[model samples]
Target chain A: MITAERKPLDEILSYIKPFKRILLLGCNECVTVCAAGGRKEVGVLASGIQMSMLKNGASIEIREHTLERQCDPEYVEELVPIIDSADAVLSMACGCGVQQLATRFKDKPVFPAVNTKFMGGSDRHGVWTERCQGCGDCLLGVTGGICPIAKCAKQLMNGPCGGSVSGVCEIGDEVECAWHLIWERLKALGLTDQYLEIMPAKDWRAGGGSGPRKIVREDLAE
Target chain B: MKTQSNLEKVLSGGHLAVTSECGPPRGASAQTVVDKAKYLEGVVDAVNITDNQTAVVRMSSLAGSVLVKQQGMNPLLQMVTRDRNRLAMQADILGAYALGIDTMLCLSGDHTKFGDHAMAANVHDIDSIQLIQMVKGMRDEGKFQGGAEIKGVVPKMYIGAAANPFADPFELRVMRLAKKIAAGADFIQTQCIFNIEKFEKWMEGVRKMGLHEKCYILAGITPMKSVGAAKYMKNRVPGMDVPQELVDRMSGVAKEDQPAEGIKICLETMERLKEVEGVAGFHIMAIDWEEKVEEIVKQAGLYPRPQV
Candidate 1:
């Protein structure tokens, strides 16, 4: 899931301060589950902004709305009617959703109310941890379902660097050494031989090293 | 003669080679490297020029190696995967070789979090093992990592890699060393040896696999300057196994005598490691205390380093 956190109240306040009216938009996707850019968060932000503005002896109009998905054009079209009533649109979604709003409402300014963090999932109640980097290709099959590219600090392919100590990374105690996890998993599965093999240099071309990537699903294309 | 590096010649000549580390200054000071090179000039076969060790920005290892080489000492250029991608790494290898650096140590350097630049992005395009293979390919096959032909003058380097016997999943450490050797690492320099018992066990595994015959294995030694240094490494430093006994020994001495006690412990470890099977040489990392290296080397009976 694409996780995010709301931008600071001050930064969001600064953006909407220039406009008399703005739409506070939220997403029902990953941000919702993470308690970041859901409908409730939109209501909370709307009230905060209104109160902050009223304390300054001025009040601005705010329209609150939450989309089923902000990154999709079909769902973004639902804002076509209400978007014109506001001076600008402040999106509380990931970068994809923010960009989608920007592209859809070219005339009205679109400000992001939240900061897009990473493509991760909720670790526990309110905590989220990154799981994937979407590095076009995946090596999870060979790595016992662990992703070194996303987890390891050095992104090493061969094995753990010398920094792996007691299943922890040198960077911090909280961070688990990805290679250590791989070794343990492989050992448990009687696949220690796989851990011995050297993974070659990664081809970063697929991971956007070449440039922005695109895919055309020929089977689903008209 | 693979690049005719002095370190290579010493190891190949069945002589216990001596190599020490010299970290480049954070600022651009060629004289600093020259000064450090003086202490290690006749004391060791090669001096390893660290590349932004601990992630702190410093004068590049290539330039430092050149400076050390100019001072009439062989420089072992250390390259880390944390800073540059394959293009920069390959380009720097060619550049370093052109500037007369023949020995290279490949490492996945300390993460940036440990360095001054914690916010910096790390570029690990190739791990240390692959870096070893790449350098060997450039030297032996005259090809780039991507298998393209080098138009002319491929870099010929005596490739080296690092090993840590104290790191966890101890059973796999020997296998990692084997993989490094198979990847074309001509020599292996281990992490600093504070826990000789663990290291000897690791060497036992190395001997079991007969990996000692495949590559030169240099035991890494660092002389602790104080009891604080020992305790810090024991508790804070990653993969360091500083036994409680060593810390107690250091603290038992007066503060003024701690430095000498530290050297004594280093000499004792080197003396013991010299008798261990599969141990090829000693890599003295006198970290900032380079002046102490000569005394350590001479007292260990490794003085008058073999002229290969």
Candidate 2:
């Protein structure tokens, strides 16, 4: 589950104020698990928006629909009829889904209801934390299971900053130092010696910093 | 006109403040959001727009509160410090304030996996304690974060925090409550309290610790309508206990009387909780059963607490 908090309601409402009828599309994938846009949430947001619009004397028609996975075109295509009738679309999916909808229905406008925060796992039942930055590299072996790119306050690849106090980040005293987490993981895996292996400079190519990155599995190619 | 600054007057003046919370529907449209909030208009003192209440993302609390505000009601934006750093929290707080939401409930939200999203990552960017401290700092220092000063007075929000006395190892729950009060929580709403006897004992302990002197505590009252609901609540809800007595009672009741029985239980709980000292009020969470709240409140004799 990629836990995401909803963006403010006002910002979301403002996006659909001008439209009379809007398609509220929810995704059952990452955004659903993240708590941003799920089927039930779509109901709540759609109903809330409809009531508010009515209260303000704006006649907005809200159609509710949820896709199995919005990131895929197959799921996005299912929303064609739902979106075809609405004035615009207020998608509760991640950025990927929203863009996919926009591309699929170039005539229809698509809006995002959530700000995709990060790629990670739940620390506990209801708390979702950012643990992976999607850096597109494999470095968890040497530094333990933790990824310094995502967990480190400074994204320090080499080691912990001296500013670390009792394993908490100094910049924000509340956060657990990523390096500390890394060290703990190393100790747990008996890979403490691996930390001593000096690594080369990070190659930014994998991270899509240069351009949109692509991965092609040779075996999958026809 | 009671401003946030004049909240003490409002609280002291014996106004039975009515507050309701909204869990954003799981989709993008606002109809469901608006419907719940609109229903709450004449029923609550203010509507609490939960920020992904229970850690499942639906609509943003700030956004939900904004909708409530548009509906001509005061909106208390429930904020969880779990997903955001100080920067994001402060920014969102400022944004919410600018949008006219003056009340904020500071919470350490549910662990992310508990809600609809179980596999999501958690951001312990700042805990509840540090969060209120930051809000208070922003309020008093007139800083817009980055230690820079904002142009006029920064809005002071009515700050509330959560207290779960029913959670296991009750002593730890008490300590957490004390921490929230010390963190500048102006009011406290307890977790869903099914057992008033247990809660009353917890209250006595709370009084002994002098936790009541610092903040106004609101007891949480949830109506359990059926054995199925009870089972789900007990089996699914973490750190929550729906007593077997009530479960047994529901099981014994006729199916038609199940909702009424649940309402009966809620009414009794509220009545009992009122007897607890230092208890300022009750927060009724119908949990999608908002329509029955008025009946529960009315049957509980909470009338004269105006819907306006």
Candidate 3:
């Protein structure tokens, strides 16, 4: 799932400081799973902002709303009634959701309350680790399911780039070397011979190189 | 011949070549680089100019290589993918070649977190292998990375890449070397060698795969300055394999004599490595101790580098 983290309280406070009436929006999707922009977080942020403003002797009316998913236009229309009443709309969703909200509610200023991190999942209850790079091409079949593009520091096709020390990446001890993990997985599956095969240079046009990518399905089009 | 570089002439002629490294100064002074090059002038075949080695910002390697060239010594310009994108890298390659640099070492330099600029974003548009292929493409095919044809003569350089035999998943190190060779790396210089036994094992794998026949393999040697240096490399430096016995030996010596003892140990390793098959030469990374390179080369019987 797409992961995100809450922006600093000071930065978020600055965005809403100019507005007398504000709407704190949250998404019930990836941000919620990551404990970043969920319904509970919206309530917590609303109270925190109110407390911060109360200390300054500035009285401001703040409202809270949570959408099923802010990326869809249908779900975004749910905010039509109260959208114009608020001076500004603060979205505690990923960048995509914030952009979608801004596009739909063209008049009101929309600010992103969270920073979208990467496409990853929670490693533990509160910890999240990156799993994929969305490189368009996936090589998990030969790599034993570990994504070197996302995990390896160099994003080496044929790696463990002379910096792998004792199953850890040179970047840090906490991070496991992607190729080391791949080698161990391949060995366990008795596919160690495949480790010698050289992975050719990637066609990065399909990855993050060409430009912003778009996929359209003619079959699903109206 | 792949360029008219002195290092290439020596290696291709089947002579045991010798190279040394010279880290560019942190400040804007070419005097430090020139002085270091003097010590290695007639002592080695080529001098590698490190590019902001360890990610600490320093004088550019291209400018340093030019200084070495001015001193009548061959400079193997080191290029790292950490700081430059493909366009900058390609332009630098052309600039280095135009400045008469004939040898190039491609690396995915040390991470920025290890240097003064910990928050700087790294622009690894290409890894070391792809960088080597890119250089080869420009030299052999006269084309840019995007496949645009060059208008005139392309930069002809002797391509080089680095290998670390001490890193984990040891069995795959040789295969990685093969990948670099297949990517058009004309030669390979390994990380500092302290564990001779481990390096010999890696060499055995290289011999089995016939990699030495494909490209020249120059083992890296760095003489430890003191027991603290040994311990630091063992514990702190990533991918370094400083054996405990060497540290114990250094610890047994007086503080003042540790440098000499370290050189003696390096001399002994070079003598033993001379007999190892597939050992093409030695790359002495004297670090800040460049003055000792001449003495080390002489004592190791590598002085009077064969005139090509």
Candidate 4:
């Protein structure tokens, strides 16, 4: 499960103070699981904004709506009436929802209540860490289950560096060197020999960062 | 200790000490809050400002409590540890005190799921009883919650808390009250009591545990004037239970006499509470009916303290 911490109340409130009407939107995907943005979060933000505004002597109407996945146009289209009616929109979803709302409602100002931090997953309750780097190619089989691209600070796919000391990272004593983790996983998988082999070149194209990437799934298309 | 003593005198000596709760409005608005605070100022002994009541974020309870203090009324700042960690809770307590709001009501608070922000996570750093113990320790030993010594010793303020005799099973209610009293709770406000017989039995159990000797317990009473209100309290509110008889009384009475009927029931409830040996006082939560509270007190003949 993905886990996320909520932003402070005052920070969320300050974003929507300008407009009398706001569309407080949420996404039911990863943001919901992590709790940064979700249906329940939207209600909370709306109530908080409403209560703060009322207590401060300014009464603003906030309309709340949560889309299944704000990144998709189909989901964005569902919120047309809510977006059109409001003077401003507060998207609680991560960067994707914020961008989608902005693109869908170009006329209305969109504010992000959550600071989208990283592409990661949760370890356990209240603990989240970066797990994926979207590094253009699949190489997990070569390095056991661990993704060296994310684990290594420098994304060194080849092997552990000279700075690795006692299984700890060189930059910070607290951090367990990712290469250390990579070695441990390889040992456990009975693939210790895999570390001896050198890694190949990295293609950043398929990672979706270099350019606008698309997947045309002909099987799923109508 | 001067204000401490003066407040004890004020509370123990009666003087129509009033307390009201701000449900941290569903949405934020200053006018409604200011109006509610102003309404309670002349009427109540002290106003209990809720800290994120029901976990749906509104104005900060400390901020609201300070606003109440600014309005010239004593505010018992309510703090819930559901959303904050231990460090923030301790800091906010001192902050509230520094802002001239002394009295505090420490609660475990409702689950975040019951709130509008169910998506919001819960941080149960310490339970309500432990929180009281921590504060009392800080005041008595000049130590923080972690047992570290605090720089300047601050005299302990009058710490009040909640008890729910009607919600939990009879045994657990008394046990919880004992635990709270043992945790250095100066005073306790019970959940609203409708069944006087059950309340009397509960008091007997409390006396047996010797809890009454250690803490002053104020019985909580709610006014059920409308049918809708009664239903909501029964179904929605977790710990509160208004008996069927009161609902019948409200229904039997004519529309015009509903107010009188409610007043009569409440007055009788208070009078019956007076007969109980351990009930120190009553905490009247009349919803929006503050004016009726004075009338109920007068009818019950609770003047200048409960004849202590």
Candidate 5:
């Protein structure tokens, strides 16, 4: 899931200060799972903004709605009827969702309330850790399921660099060395032969190094 | 000989090789490199010029290597994966070879967090192992990493890589060395040896795997200048192992005699490592203390380096 955190209240307020009526949107997808831009968060933000505005001796109208998935065009179109009543659309979803709303409603100003951090999963309650870099090419099978592209600070492929000490990265103590985990896992699984083989230099073109990437599925196209 | 480099000739001639590091100055001072090279010229087989070692910005190792070459010394040009992508690396290899540097060391390099510029983004586009393979391919296959054949005068390099016996997952350190050797590392320069027992144990593994026979393994040595330097490496430096006893030994000595004690300890390590089978030679890393190289080399009985 893509994890995110709500932008500071001041930054969000500054974006919508010029508008009278604002449509506060939410996503039930990744942002919802991370509890950053769920329906509950939308309500919390709306009330916070209203109270803050009232304290400043001003009144503003905020209409709240949480879509099944703000990234999809069909779910975004659900706001067509009520979007006209609002001055601007303030999305509590990830960057993809905000862009979706902006693209769908051509003339409306779309503002993001939460900062999309990374494509990751929750480690525990209130803690999310990145697991993949979407490098397009995956070497997880060889690396014993640990993603070096995302986990290793230097993105080393063969093994850990000289800085890995006591299973910790040079970056910090909290960050465990990804290659250490790989080596341990491979040894336990009796697959040290896989670790012995040298991994080639990565072809980063698939990782969006060339440019923004797009996938076209002719079978699913209309 | 692979590249006809003096280090290669020495190692291939069945003699223990002596290599030492020469860190380029942070500022562009060719004279600094020349000054350091003079101390190491006849005392060592090759001078390992670092490429932005520890991620601090420094003179390009290629340029530093050329300056050392100008002084009639073999410069083991050290290139790190942390700074350059394959394109730039290969270009520099070609450029370095064209300018008369033939031996090179491939390293993953220290993280930028340890350097002055912590905010800099690192480019580990190719890890050190792949880099060794890339250099080998360029030399042996006469082809680029993309498989395009070179039109003329391909870079023929004697490739070297770093090894850390003290790093975690100790069981895999030898295997990692095996991968590097398989990837075409002609020689191996290990991290500094403060913990000799662990290093001997690692060499036992190396001998068990018979990797020592395949590549020349140069033991790294860095003499402590002070007690504070010893403790700092023990606490702050990553992958560095400075046993408490060594630190205690340094502190036990008088303040004025610490540097002498440090060199004495270093010479003792060299004497011990000299007897270890499969131990190729030494890589004395007297960083910023180049003048000490001649004394250290002479005192260790490795002076009057073998003329290959």
Candidate 6:
């Protein structure tokens, strides 16, 4: 799921300060699963903004709404009535959702209330870690199911990068070395021979190198 | 001849090539760079100019390299992937080359959180390995990263990269060095080494792979000025492996004599490392104690770098 965290109160407050009526938009897809931009977060953010505005003796109204998925145009069109009544829309979704809302509501000033972090799943309740870099090329099979592109600090194709100590990354103790985990998994699987096979240089153009990417589906296109 | 850089000549000549670092001043002044270069002159083959090392804002390495060149010393400009994207980096490579700078060290710089500018946005458009490959392509193929042909001469530089023998999963260090060498790094300068035993173990791995023969390998050495300095590196610096015994050695000494003792430890490390099978040279990173480099080199009997 796409994960994110709410922007700081001050930064969010500054974005909506000029507007009198604001809509706190949330997404029910990835952001909801990640607990970042969801119905619950929308209510909490609305109440916090209201309290902050009240303390400042400023008159501001914030309405909360959650779409099934903001990335879809059909779900985004559902926001027309509330968005028409609001002066600005603060999206509590990932960057994709925010851009979707902005594209659908061209006249309304749409702003991001949360910073989209990465594409990852929760390791446990209330704890999320990055598991993929959307490198556009997958090597999990060769890597013993570990994603070195996202997990390794240097994204080394064949490495623990001289910075892995005791299975932990040099970046910090909290981060585990991706290659260390790969090596252990490979050893357990009796594929230790593959460890000596050198990985060739990555073709970054397949990743996020050339520019913004797009996918074309001939079967689904109108 | 790797574009005629003196450091390249020394390393290719099979001498124990000596290189040292000279950080650019925090303020806009060329005097500090010139003065520091003087300390390294004749004692080392070349001087590495750090690029906003530790993420602190300072005089740019490109500008500082030009200043070092003016002093008749070769400058190994350190380029980090943290600040600029491919366009700026490629342009700077061309500009630096045009200015007669013939060597560069590719690095994924220290995170900005470690510096005063903690809030600065980092741009890691490419990592150091890619940077090495890109520079190699530019030099050998005369093409940009996107395959655009350069209309004029390409930057011909002796490519360099860093390694950390202390950082863990210790067995993989040599493999990583091999990767860098495969990516076109002509030389390798390691992080500060305080644990000689650990470093030699790493060197043994490198020799097993015969990687030292693929590229020049220089062991990094930073002389600790005091016990406080030793503690600071052990506690604060990431990936720095300062063995507890060295700290004890410094702590056992009188406060006033710690500096000399620090020099002795460095001298000893160089002497012992000289015997390591794959070791090709010493990269002295005195870090504000540049004055001690000459003595360290002389006492270690590595002075009079062969005039190639």
Using TM-score as the measure, which candidate wins? 1
DockQ, in order, for the candidates? 0.84, 0.02, 0.60, 0.01, 0.84, 0.38
| Candidate 3 positional error at A38, Å | 0.8
What's the true lDDT of residue B301 in model 2?
Answer: 71
Global lDDT scores for all candidate models: 0.92, 0.73, 0.91, 0.71, 0.92, 0.88
Better of 2 and 6 by DockQ: 6
lDDT of 4 by residue, A53-104 (tens): 8898989888888888888899899976556688888888888778987887
True contacts kept of 2: 0.00
- Residue A210 lDDT in candidate 2: 74
lDDT ranking, best first? 5, 1, 3, 6, 2, 4
Better of 5 and 6 by lDDT: 5
Interface C-alpha RMSD after superposing true interface residues, each candidate, one decimal:
0.8, 15.7, 1.7, 26.1, 0.8, 3.2
Q: Candidates' TM-scores?
A: 0.99, 0.58, 0.96, 0.56, 0.96, 0.88
Q: Over all chains combined, what TM-score does candidate 3 have?
A: 0.96
Model 1 DockQ reads 0.84
Over 4 Å off in model 5, which ranges? Answer: none
lDDT of 5 by residue, B1-308 (tens): 77888999999888888999899999989999999889887999999999998899999999999999999999999999988889999999999999999999999888899898899889999999999999999999999998999779989999999999998878888989999999999999999999999999999999999999999999999999889889998998888999999999999999899999999999999999999999899999996788999999988888799988
- State which docking tier applies to candidate 3: medium
| Comparing 3 and 5 on DockQ, the stronger one | 5
Give native contacts recovered, as a fraction, per prediction.
Answer: 0.85, 0.00, 0.52, 0.00, 0.88, 0.32
lDDT of 5 at B104: 98
Off by over 4 Å in 3: none
Query: Can you give the lDDT of residue A126 in candidate 1?
Result: 86
Question: Candidate 5, residues A103-183: lDDT per residue as tens digits?
Answer: 999999999999999988877898999999999999998888899999999999887888888899989978999999998
DockQ of 2: 0.02
Flag regions of model 4 displaced more than 4 Å.
A1-222, B1-7, B11-18, B26-29, B153-155, B302-308
For residues B229-277, what per-residue lDDT tens digits would candidate 6 score against the true structure? 9999998787789999999999999999999999999988888898898
lDDT of 3 by residue, A71-155 (tens): 9899999999989889999999999999999999888899999999999988899999999989998989999999888998878
TM (chain A) per model: 0.97, 0.93, 0.97, 0.86, 0.97, 0.97
